[model samples]
Structure formats: C-alpha cells, structure tokens
Target: MDLRTANMEKNWQLLAGGDRQGLYACFDLFYDDLFRLGVSLYRDVDLVQDAINELFLELWKIRERLGEVRNIQQYVITIYKRVLYKSRHVRQEFASLDECIEMPQSSYEEALIAIQTDERRKALLQQALQQLSERQRQMVQMRYYEGRGFREIAETTGLTERTVYNTLHNALQALRKGMERVE
Candidate 1:
C-alpha cells in the first residue's frame, strides 16, 4: 500500500482499539473529502458540516463494534450518505406550513411507495457506478454531478477532450447495461 492508504489503515486500527488520538487522526485525514462529498450531494455548507461532525461522533461511539473495513473511504462514504440524507430529510420535514401547503397533497401510502421506489432506483444506480473503473466513475461524476464541461474535465483530469468524451460514453453504456440487468 501507498503511504496515505497505509496511514489510514493504521489510524483505523488505532480507533478500533479505543485510542482517542486515532479518532482525531481519522477526522483530520477525511474531513476535506467528507466535506466535499457532502457539499456535492447538498449545497448547504452548515448542514454538511453538521452531518460530518455527527458522522464522526457516531463512529467514535460505535468504534468497538465496528468490524474491519477493507476500503475505509468507501465505507465512510456509504454511512455519510445515509447521515446526510437523513439530515436533509429531517430539515425538509420541518418546512414552514405555507411552504408545505403549497405542494400537492398525497396520501401516506402513496408517499411511502414513492420514497421506496426512489430509494431503490438510487441504490441500483450506486451499484452500477461501483461497477465502473475509478477513472470512468470520476469522469462520470465530474460531467454529470458537478456539471463540468468536457474541456474543463479534460483539463482538470489531464486527459484529452476526446478521451474524456469517450470515457464518459463507455461509462454510460456500462451503467445502462448494469441497470438493465437488474430490471
């Protein structure tokens, strides 16, 4: 493993062993990445910060029970996504009465079904994304999630524009096939 990955694994082990410093080290190492991911999912800085803090606190609390993680970044990200989504959902639930009334009213069952369907689709998409190569996934996120242009992505990734386009195209094709297999 490279220096960074080795360091992360060491800190993860320390944290699991009940070392406080390990918690801090892990926080320091992952803060920027978690922040960026939170911001990318939701534009609210305060909400993102709060979610990240809560994530670490929960991790520390459950440290002993946590099992070995092969990919710490991905594991944290999966948990972080759930936390961030729950935070956002709670915030929306408390929206002003006027704002709430402005929307169309649906029965509880209908809303529940819609939510389940959306969650299923999201899960499927995530699985499909995980099937892609790292470079393909990165390019896909830049082009779609970050709304970056082909030229800009090419410049930032040190890849030619044509290469970026081709990569994205292949990624999309792969994603389609993956999703289709499920349906």
Candidate 2:
C-alpha cells in the first residue's frame, strides 16, 4: 500500500475503535482536496458539496470496510467519481458550476419549519401515489423505491420489456403533471 493509504488505514482503525475526533481530523484533511476534484467534474458547487456529503455518508456506512481501504485518497476519489458517473448515466448532470444554489443557514426554529415543509411534500407525494392505478403504483415503486431496471421489472411482472418501459415513462409523465397541479 502507498504511504497515504497506510495512514488512512491507521485512521480507519482509530475510527472503528471509536476515535471520532481522529475520524473528524482525517475528514477535514481530505475534504478540500476531494471537493476540488468533485467540482472539477460537476462544475456545480452544490453538486460538489453533495458529492462530498454522499462520499462521507458512504464512508461512515461502510466503516467496517474502511480498514481494508489501503488508499484513503483513492477511496474518497473513487466515491466522488462514481457519484459523477452515476449522475451522468442517470441524465442528471448539473448545468454549470455558476448555477449552483446556495442554502443559507437557518436558526433552530426555521430548521423545524423547513422540516415540516419537507414532511408536507412527502405526504403529498404519498397521497398522489395512493391515487395511482395499481399497475402505475407498482411500476413507480419498482423503478424508484426498489431501484429496479426496466428489464428487471419486466421479469418480475411478466410484462414484455417494452411494455414495462412504456408504462414507467407514461406513469412518470402522469405523476409529473399531477405534481404540477398539486404544486
């Protein structure tokens, strides 16, 4: 392993051993470098920040595997790269770095208000889903909530692949129009 990876392994061990301060220190050290790489690809500052947040979230989620990561920088870079790759593959590439939206920090009460707003939106979506036909609901749930590909949904539902694809597309368009009306 490289020297950086060796140091990372040590940090991972420390973190797994409950040394949170050490983990945070390592995170701070790597954050700027990783963010630069993410920004280089994504161009959007929010995407850069989101990529870092997701990378860190994945790191913590797979903490048990951290010790196996010989190259800490490599691991973090891979996370950001994979995120960018996925975003591009999913057709969600950011428009531009200059177009990044900045969210202002809110006080405790405002945070609670924001949380309630999010809850209402989620409830609205749930209500909309409930209004979908059984087939539409199943397709939506499979494609999104369960993260299945069209081919996979076809296999599961015994529908032809084209039928599954068309159903999902139409269902999503309907959902978009429905949400527009609600909004």
Candidate 3:
C-alpha cells in the first residue's frame, strides 16, 4: 500500500483498538477537510461544525464495531453526508411547519376575523422577508411565491442552478428564523 493509505490503515486499527490518541489523530487529519465539505454543502458554518462534532462523537461511540474500513477518508465522508442529510431533513420539517401553516373553515364572522388575521400574517411575513438580502429575497420570491423552478430562476436571475438553490436555502432559513421571532 502507499504511504498515506498505510498510515490511515494503521490509524484506523489503532482507533478500532480503542487508542484515544489515535482517535485524536484521526480527527486532526480529517476534521478540516470535512468541515470545508460540510460548509459548502450546508451553507451554515455553525450547523456544519455541529454536524462534524456529532459525527465524531458517533464515530467514537461505534468505533469498536465499525470494522475494517478500506479508506478512512471516504468512510468519514459517508458518515458526514448522512449526518448532514438528517440535519437538513429535520430543519426543513420544522421550518415547513412555520412557513406553511394551514387554516380551518369558519363562519362569516370568523371568516372576517380570519381575513384580518391573514392580513396580519402577510404583514408579518413581509417584515420577515424584508430582513433577507435583496438577492435572497428575490430568489425566495421566484422559487416559492412566483412558482419558478431552480433552472428558470437561474436563467432569469443570471445565477447558476446551484447558486439559486443555495441562495433560496439560505433565504428560507433566514425567513424561518425571522418568522419565529415575529410570531
């Protein structure tokens, strides 16, 4: 085996054998690159850091059972991707609840109140949306309110598809937080 692969195999064995220093060494080798990947994928440094920390903690917990990883770098990245996916799924679920709340049917008097309530909700949402940067607000409006696809938004806005997705993701995150505060 090559030198780096050999070194990684040795470190993996040591970690699986429960060597504390070997665990630290593995972390030192992998954390920075993993953090960079996480940040690029998630767009939130704090959330990425939390994901990395949780990933290492889980790795430590299950190290003994992890068994014979051929490539430690790939293995760690696979685990990290899973963690990031789960984190994103959770955030989307909670944010969807806040952003897409449903209303029930009511009588005329209640309907009038509902109309006023809807107006207030729209004002609150507008205030929340205003807090985002102009680019983010535009991306969000195009994607969510205007019913444009990412590719269409990209074409119209002169941004790449990935850039549109990232901008809308950050915008939605900010809108969720702002709406929470407004409510």
- Name the top lDDT candidate: 1
Worst 10 residues of 2 by lDDT: 103-112
lDDT of each: 0.87, 0.73, 0.80
Count of clashing residue pairs in every prediction: 0, 1, 0
Q: Give the C-alpha miss distance for residue 41 in model 3, angstroms.
A: 0.9
Clashing pairs in 1: none
- 1 against 3, candidate with superior lDDT: 1
Give lDDT tens digits, candidate 1, residues 1-183. 899898998998999889999999999999988877776667566678899999999899989865577778898898899999999999888997677645444544554466578899899999999999999999999999999999999999999999999999999999999999987
Model 2 agreement with the true structure over 1-183: per-residue lDDT tens digits:
777666766776886565776578668778778766765665555555666777767667777767666656677788778976676555445455577566564444554466578898888788778778899899999999999998999999999999998888888877777777787
Candidate 1 weakest lDDT stretch, 10 residues: 103-112
Pairs clashing in candidate 3? none
Give one digit per residue, the lDDT tens place, for model 3 in 78-148: 99999988887876677765586554434444544655788988998999988999999888888888999
CA error at residue 165 for candidate 3, angstroms: 51
Estimated TM-score per prediction? 0.52, 0.43, 0.49
TM-score of 2: 0.43
Off by over 4 Å in 1: 97-183
Candidate 3, superposed: residue stretches over 4 Å from native: 1-3, 95-183
